[model samples]
Target: MATAGGGNAHMVFRRYLDAVGLQGLASAEAAGLHTSEWYALSLITLEGSLSSGELASRTGLTTGATTRLIDRLERAGYARRAADPHDRRRVI
Candidate 1:
């Protein structure tokens, strides 16, 4: 019989797979979205509008990589960064 920890681990793995499967379906439905775009979208949905730096942190992306993701999102009309309300030096 599986121990409680083993059972929990199995459930966790199943949950992860389920989430991945859903993401895959969503990505396929999106005309131009691949895994990276999906990842960025998921982060934006969960975290709301963020500066490029903040978006990078939430998505586990480097600044350059995040910029690429933002470009994709912008092209796809999924995201945009507004100028920071308090700081004119940045977009959020």
Candidate 2:
């Protein structure tokens, strides 16, 4: 059971999430991208840079799906993959 204050907080958080989702949808549409692409872009922007594997984990997408997502983002000029500075074998 939640206290009244806790319930209000939950409502506020839910509203915030809804607002963010709406904004994200609008942004994605403006950018000519799918919602998932926008989400991946958001994650990348938040992290500054991350590996595709890390992105997959964060997005709850499989490696192949994440790869495809990255492909679309790259094609749309929203993101780029580069070799990690210290690890040539890893991409960022």
Point to the candidate with the largest lDDT: 2
Judging by TM-score against the true structure, name the best candidate.
2
Which lDDT tens digits does candidate 2 get at residues 1-92? 55466677789998999999899999999989989988899899888889999999999999999999999899878899899999999999
Candidate 2 has an lDDT of: 0.91
TM-score of each: 0.71, 0.80
Off by over 4 Å in 1: 1-19, 25-31
Worst ten in a row by lDDT for model 2? 1-10
Candidate 1 collision pairs? none
Candidate 2 collision pairs? none
In order, candidate lDDTs are: 0.82, 0.91
- Sequence-dependent TM-score of model 1: 0.71
